[model samples]
Target chain A: MLVYIYDGSFPGLLTAIYESYYRREKPEEILAQDQWQHTLFAQEVVIKTDEKKADKVYQAIKDKISGFAARNAYCVFLAEVPGAEMLIYNYLSRGWKLGAKLDFHLADEAVLQVHTVAKKVRQEAHRMLGLVRFRLLKHELYYAQIEPDHNILQMISPHFARRMADQNWIIHDVKRGLAAVYNQVEWVLTPLERPKTISLDETGLFYESLWQKYFSSIAIKSRKNLRLQRSFLPKRYWKHLVEMDESRSRFAESSVLSPQSPVKTYK
Target chain B: MELLEKLEILANAAKYDVSCSSSGSTRKNKAGGLGNSYASGICHSWSEDGRCISLLKILLTNYCIYNCAYCVNRSSNDIPRAYFTPDEVAKLTVNFYRRNYIEGLFLSSAVITSPNHTMELLTETVRKLRNIHNFNGYIHLKAIPGADLELIKEAGSLVDRMSVNIELPSASGLKLLAPQKKQDLIIRPMDYIKLQIYEHKEERKISRKVSHFVPAGQTTQLIVGATPDTDLNILQLSEKIYKNYELKRVYYSAYVPVSEHPKLPQISQPPLLREHRLYQADWLLRFYGFRAEELLNESQPNFDLELDPKTNWALRNLHLFPVEINRADYETLLRVPGIGVKSAQRIIRARQVRAVTFDNLKKFGVVMKRAQFFITCRGKYGGQISLENKLLRQYLIAKPKPIQHSSPYEQLSLFNESVPSIPSEVMLSNLTGEL
Candidate 1:
């Protein structure tokens, strides 16, 4: 089995896809530089990142199939799954053969895997639109920090820019160390220094308390469903919410409808 | 009064209006505007009751002239009343949107002084939010019933969506529960908005510069379990409203008993499962191509709480079962128990290349547990038994978890003798079958 390794960048993965195609042999796995494991019987190939080679493959995908297919590949690239590098390569090779009709091959494993992985990225982007909480910084720019499982900063920024067009805001992806900043005009992506700390203003604290009060007051005391709340806005996303501050979650514990009865109240 | 005090009363009054969606409007942000709307709504937070909070749902004022019996803000209730000026409401909306606390504003009100006077306030508030404040966030305003048509029309053009609640399902139910709110007064504004929405589309097609009216269309709420109106009556009414008004949604708010009217149920909790079943049947009517009359009838006026509306419908129509997975049409595929709109489309696309077996069908997102009994894979049966026996019915619906006896006395009596205890419907059905 031949295993190909490359740097952990989108262009690097596309270059690896190009190398495996000309090698005329199917590799068992495509590994990022950090993700490689030593196996006794496997042959290894190390590929360097080449912008020209990656561009050629990307353009070939758009020319042969459609730009829509190229977008599918890009979304899958951001998924950052362990072995997505090879799956995308195989899917595109089949696309070259099928031309614009490649999307019809939903039964193929490589095609279905890319579609499934891209769907996860799309869902994460959609969920972040709802879950992102902005804090008014002392500097008066709206600042929000998210640590999503997927790298969805680029996908979700356009939504905030369209909605919060008149305000200056920054959405920092803490896990990925990148930020999408909107300066009351167009948005720009820049590298963010990790472990970013923000100081909240007095007005921000005032509204935060009001929001926490409104959030707690709106729920019906007779129908408290923790499991349902956890399913929609999971525990992982709770830490970022202004309403899910530590005191209220503890306050919520004493207000469970009934600790014993799990039956939905209806006949 | 403090902002917190006013927010508490207004939000408490507005909680019963269960239309929480900030969806279906494609309004975009202008150069200096504050926000935009997405086609599918965004939910910012979930409350402890597991309800989504998409918009800052608050009443403009809780002071009222009319006393609708079911309303928490009725004049006889003796609750504290508060009002927000138009400037205050618009500033609140812009501030909340900036902090990502809400998608937009859902502004509703009681009949302050009179209906026309109240609607003028609502219109002024949205007009300021759009024109003066330059806030383009998704606004869902209330269309005050019996308000002047000019006021409703002028407000409809400024906001993304408007709703005039039918409130009760039947005219007699309206007369009994809310004596002052006649059926004609509620529906007249609805019809006017519907016609304006229709006319705006025609106007937009003729010239690209013509402004859109109520771009997200209209929606309304119907209170479930407050009256004798059955599921049949409610669904049929919603069907007419959808067909006639081209309504975007018909939200069902399970009656939370806040008042002690003699005609209403004296239950401790809302009929939640009934509301859930109504939502499922409503989905069937909207997306699954099932008509209202087909799901329920006069003989069986209510839905079965044990099973979902789709599964219940499939059980009643046994002859439509065991559809061929490889050859069935899209409509027939949707009728199968586990095949939804998404999975059905996936099946149509995937089966064009190769024959789909039951295993492959699972990959397309068909719930194998439910679909196995309703479909055939290349003339091969996947289910153990067809829909010929009652066991199939029992297997499809999950048995409710047994009731826990947490009290000490009830637990102590368990060791005394043979306790012929039936904790759930599953056990009761099993015991009756044995006898």
Candidate 2:
């Protein structure tokens, strides 16, 4: 089986797709050279990183499988899963033959793996849709930060761009250090090396107080099942939730108000 | 105060009302807004019991004058109560919206001072959020049952959606459970809101102007298992509400045994599976073109808890089975067991250019295990079944007999029974003829 290798990049993966299609002889495995180590009885082919080849391969997949499938497959590659290259290679070759019908039940191992990876990426995309909390910056740019499990920077960009088309926004993936920026008409992604910083308006504290008060008021005291709440939403993610901010200030004030009684209530 | 303490009192009160969803609305923020509504609503985080804490589903106050037996916040229950001011609510919404912790507000309250007094407070809060605070986000306001029509109308104008819960399915149930509330009190406000929405829509067509009606439409909640009401009775009420009021949705909240009450059922947990079946039945009524009478009647009060509503219906009506996959219409295809909207749509689209075989049906996402007995593709059947037998009806809908060993005493003792009993083979022999 011929093993195809490319630099660990989305474009480079597209270049590998170009080589696999150009050579009519299909291989048993496709491995990235960086991830590939010495293996016995394996025929290796190094694919030169070419933009034109990558674009051609990308266009072919879009025309053949589906535009959605092409994008999803590219994202599955970004997940950096072990044996993702071979999975993509098998998926593409079979996808061309099966058309849109390839998504349903099948016996092929590669097809199964691709389906699992696609589902995982899709799940992450959905989570980010709800979790990407945007904080308004002083510069009128709606800025948000998230640390998602997958590289879902590009997956959620179009949704916000279309929905918030009138406003300027930036959603930075803290873990991946990438950002999706929308300026009126369209959106673009770049390495988030220098994000636009903003000063906290004095009204920020006021808003926080109001939110903490509301959160406290709305919560049902009788149904305060902490075990159940913690089970559904872990305390680990509580730092990002703004309603929990009052506890810090409440701690600072509790010493002055109570000399002996325990600070039982937060906010 | 401990947020936990407040949450316990308020949520326990709110939990009984049973309308905790941020879905079924399609509202976007206008210009100069910080947040927008998602078509398929956003669930920011899930609560401990796996409930979606999407919106801050809470009440303005737990103090009510009405005596509703099912409600923990009923005037009869001497519990500690709290209320949030209009400014407090608006401020809360803005902060929560900014943090992406909530989509908007689901503000419900008991009739604190009076119907008008509570309605005014609720409307004031929503108005402040929209006009004073410039907060344009999704808001679902609960209309007080006996509130003045004008106040309810004002609330409808301010919020995206409004719900007046029909807690009991029957007027008799209401009389027994909540003597203070009347059927007309709940249904009238809903009727007024419905008419106002229509009136606004009709006026907007003539002039290039927009009136903020209840843009997301109105919904109501029905508390299940609280009273001796059948599924047929409940669904009949739902059908009436849907047809007459033009409701966007009817939320069915399975009754949870919160307090040790003599009137309520002694259920250990909420009949969630039954509620799930009702939701499935509701979907069938809304989307699948099934009537309420077809699924339930006076004789069969409860849904078949063992089987899903669609599958149960399909099994009972065996004559409709073995439908031709390639030729059946969309509605006909929807009637097939185990076929959801997505699967049916996939089949219809995939079979447009080519004939479908059993193998091809698998590719179209048909659940082969369940669909195998129900569909034929290219004159080929996958399961062995006699289609013409009159006894198939008996085979399909027969309820499984409870095993003698399954008794509570037997379960607790965990001891072998020496009593005379029907043998396994004998039981199978008896059931096989019925099947």
Candidate 3:
């Protein structure tokens, strides 16, 4: 059984898909470079990232299937799940046979997995539209910091750019060390390193206090439910929230974090 | 007072209101403006009670002339009273919106001195937000009862959504709990807003830009459990209003006991479960095409605390069950237990290509555990055993221990309460997505 491996990049995975079709042999599994799990009796095939080869596979999917289906395949690849490379390969192979009608085969696991993973990315992107809280930096830039589980920076940035069109803002994906910067008129994505410190200007600091006051005041006193609060905004997100201060998180739970409870709290 | 202090008092005064949705408006961002609105409202944060805080929901002032027993801002209550100037409110909305702290302003107020005086200030705040600040975000304004119709129309013109809250479900409750408020005073504005919305639609056909008059339409609220109104009475009233007013939504706020009144029940907390059940039943009325009389009669007045309203209805009407999956129409499939709007649509879409089985239906979003007893997959039955109606209810309604899987120590705290297993198929009629 052959196991295909590629660099942990979406185009790299697409190149691997092109190789499987070129070889006329289906790989048993496809894993990322760092994601090898030591499969017994598996012949490993390392595929390099070639832009031309990846473009060939990309054009085939886009030309054969509708653009919507092609975009769905790309998003599914971005989900970055362990065996997503092989899942896309299976989906594309089926798509080439049936064109745009391939997505209608929801009963097929390969098709369903593509839908599920793309949905996960889209859902997270929608959630980030609300979860992002911009801070007023001393230099008068509206900045927000997010450490999302998925690489949803591009997905969520367009929304902010449209909404805050006149304001110069930067949305930093702290986990991936990338940023989506909007300079009043247009927006662009660039690589960013984690900043050493983030200082809130006096106006930003004042509004944060007012917002915290508003947040706490709005909660119905008779219904002090930490469980429901944690369920919606989860613990891992609390560190970034101005109102959900460290004290609130500490008072809500024990030292030991439960897995079922929100996935992340503090770094 | 500082802005923070005022926000605390004003938000405290406005806490009883449960209309937190910033939906139904799809206004896009202007060329040099601040924010826009999505059709499905964005929830920035949820409060401790699991209520979505979509908008910067606060009052313009906590000061009031009328002393309503149920209101925290009643004149005699002597709570810390603060009034935000129209400029302050406009700036506050823009600031919070720019920071992504809120969707927009849910601006309500107590009747200060007079309804006209309070409404004029509220309308001015929104007008300033739009004209002066160039804020194009969503603004949901409350139509003050007994205020001038001209002022109400002006406010409706500026804002996306307008509401006149029928705080008490029944007129008698309004007379007893809120002596100053009359039912006609509230209904008049609602009727006027509805007529204007109808007129605007007709006018928009002639001219595409008819100023988008109350473009998101009107909504109102009913404070449940505050009066002796039964679920039947509440649902009937809601049904009547929905048909008559063409209102966007009817918000149900479970009455949280704020002040002591001789007539009011001294319950410690709001009737959340009942509110939840009513919302579920309301969903049935609006979307599922079930009527109030069908769901509840004199024999069954209140909803069962254990079973949801749809499940309850399905169990009673078991003769309609075991529907053939391949042939069942969309409406019939919807009546089956656990078949929601999304799943029903999925089933219809999937069946267009090929015959569906348990595997296909599962992928199609059907909830099999509840739906199994009701549906058949091409003449094949999945149920291993069939019990009598009584035994089946006992099986379905029994609470599976939530803490058993975690550990024994989970039993020590009641805060680790058993969560309702249902994903709450019920949603607000106006809102598109689940809460």
lDDT of 2 by residue, B221-294 (tens): 98888999999898888988999999989999878666667777888777787888999999999999899988
Please name the candidate that would achieve the greatest TM-score relative to the true structure: 1
Measured by lDDT, the strongest candidate is 1
Question: Model 1 over residues B1-435: C-alpha lDDT tens digits?
Answer: 998988888888888888989888898888877788888989988998898989998899999888777778888898899998888888888888888889999999999988999999999999999998888778999999989999999999999999999898999888888999999999999999999988989989999797889998999999998888899999999999999889989999888888898867788899899999999998898999999989998888899988888888899999988899889999999989889999999889878877887877888899888889999989998896776877998888766579877854454464779565556776877879953
Question: What tens-digit string does per-residue lDDT give for candidate 3 at B17-84?
Answer: 88888889888889898889988888898887777788989899988898888888889896799989
Candidate 3 is graded, for docking, as medium
Evaluation by TM-score, superior candidate among 1 and 3: 1
* TM-score of chain B alone in model 1: 0.91
Worst 10 residues of 3 chain A by lDDT: A250-259
* Candidate 2: tens digits of C-alpha lDDT, residues A28-107: 66666667887888888887899998888888788877887686688688676787777787788788888766654243
lDDT at A208, model 2: 53
Task: Indicate whether candidate 1 or candidate 2 has the larger DockQ.
Answer: 1
- Per-residue lDDT of A1-267 in model 3, one digit per residue for the tens? 899888977778888888888898898888888888677899999999999998888888888976777888778776766667777788888899878777776777787888888888888777778889888876678878888777888877778888998898888887876777777867777777766555556787778778888888899878778888888877887777777865232222112211122221211
The DockQ of each candidate is 0.54, 0.20, 0.53
True contacts kept of each: 0.73, 0.27, 0.73
Query: By TM-score, highest first, what's the ranking?
Result: 1, 3, 2
How many Å off is the CA of A204 in candidate 1?
Answer: 2.3
